[model samples]
Target: MSEFAFEVALCALLERERDEIIARQLGASVHGRRIMDIVCVEPGPDFAKRVAITPHEIPDAAIESRAGVGQARYYRNCFDMHPDRARSVAERAIEIGFFERVRQGSRLYVRQTARYPDEWFGKLVGIENKPDLAVPGDLELQLRKDVSLGVFDEVILATESYVTGAHLNRIPDEVGVWRFRPETGGLEVVREPTALDPAASGVDIVDEYAGRTDMRVATAAEKARLRRRMAERAYGKGWRSFDLPPCVHGAAKTVSGADGIPYCEWKESVVNPAEECGPACPGYEPADPPEIDIEAVRDRRTPWVANPKGPRTQSGLDRFL
Candidate 1:
């Protein structure tokens, strides 16, 4: 199976089996360019509170700003970033119902609709998918980076190849291994992962050369911020992030109870619409995209809420403006 197809199948299976929020191809590193294949965000005590806030991602800048629920602060004073960036962040926050804004004279003041939930998500499990382990491109290095960073609670490597001692020895001991079959939707744990300490400071491998390697130290606080940002993004952006192709043969295929998978009839399997479907293909025929309500499917199948009532009312300043 292609990596994209394998990833979608695994995500579908995981969504059906686990209650955690599943997201695909997310930036998981704090200061490095590490993109995780799949991320599983387990809900914490305040998961419901997060769901009540908004169905979209609350801007990290807005969340990190000085704005609070009890008192409104000068919009510009709330953020440490540039004035233009701050204004943009505040606008997004207000639009998403996470913040309420009011204009006083020519200045704008803002406050959180509700206090940001610190414990909205629990352990984050980062999964790396390499269906064919024979062509393991940067697999060992990526797993090493994840282990050293300790950003994820547990790191796992998922593949379709048969396990061998040589393959296991190449990766870190802390990392777990999973043999998954996309055809049968079967997952076998080859090696259990050791829990990493997210509260401790971590070392990020910045770059590597023939002789020397550059590195940066990430504080626990930094990791915490990244974790929050990642979880919020996962909550807003689920695994079904792809668009269905606008080809006659393209359709939404149901796999493991999760709908909205981009399946091509001509290919007779899951396909990466962005790369595979186009006028270049011989099977291509112009047609309206399939009417698949991905959001409704997510609402019905997952704990995520859609079009939820805002937790707080706006300040009613729009009418005056």
Candidate 2:
């Protein structure tokens, strides 16, 4: 099976096996984003753990470096692109301590006190997936980097390859190893990973560049900000957060198959629902169902707040429940 298929199947199994878990999201070595195949987040009340799902305009360096202080207009304009979210975020900024009300004057000025809560998420686990360890590409270096980064509480490598002493020797000792079974959606722990001290160890924000680059240690505050940002993203957009392709029947109904993957009765196969589906697909049929709801919800923080102009929406809490 293709890696994408394996990833999809694994996610399907994880969604069920780890239902209590708050969120899961896919990641890659993307710019400014955390590096991990799959990020599993465990929610908590800590200021650092909580993340606002509302798509508020992030303050630029000029505003953020100003010691969390900014004018009401500053925030308003920041959210100008997303006018619908402006009021909620403006109010939420104060409610969540991101901003402090200076005065509700003619301009309604406010100061940015905090960008994100100090502790909202409790534990974060980074998982690296490799169906065939024998064809590993820079696996050792990647695992080593993760161990040194110490951003996640634990780093685990999940693979469908057979476990052997030789394979274990090639992997980092600090990294956890999991033997995955795609057929049964089973995972067996071959090695347990050790927790790292974030403050003491420090994390590497950027990966090695030009084969030889300086590794800067990230401060606790920097790490906190990154964690908050990632958690907010995870909460707002789960790995399964994708628009389903409309079928000839109006809506493409999705279900988990015996192999722990999305099964489409229309396609009579394990369909990749993450991608677009329509007339382009081989299984296209035009039999629209009556009373079908066609909508897409991007933000899931405040469902009560109506967005008649936009697609349907719901709260992340509601999704979790």
TM-score against native, each model: 0.95, 0.63
Candidate 2 per-residue lDDT over residues 106-173, each given as its tens digit: 54456665444445456777788788887848777777767766767888888898889988898878
Q: Candidate 1 at 8: error in angstroms?
A: 0.7
Q: Any runs in candidate 2 off by more than 4 Å, and if so which?
A: 19-34, 46-117, 201-214, 246-268, 273-321
List lDDT for all candidates, in order: 0.89, 0.55
Clashes of 1: 0
Best by lDDT: 1
| Candidate 1: segments with Cα more than 4 A from true spot | 312-321
Residue by residue across 1-321, what tens digits does model 1's lDDT show?
A: 899989998998999898889999999888888999999999887776777789999989988889999878899999998999999999999999999987788989999988888887999999999999999389988998999999999999999999999999999999999999988999999999999999999999877779987789999999999999899899899999998989999999897566998989998988898999998989999888889899999987777777776663223212211
Candidate 1 yields a Cα-based lDDT of: 0.89
lDDT of 1 at 177: 96
Quote model 2's TM-score.
0.63
Q: What is the C-alpha RMSD of each candidate to the true structure, in Å?
A: 5.3, 7.5
Which 10-residue span in candidate 1 carries the lowest summed lDDT? 312-321
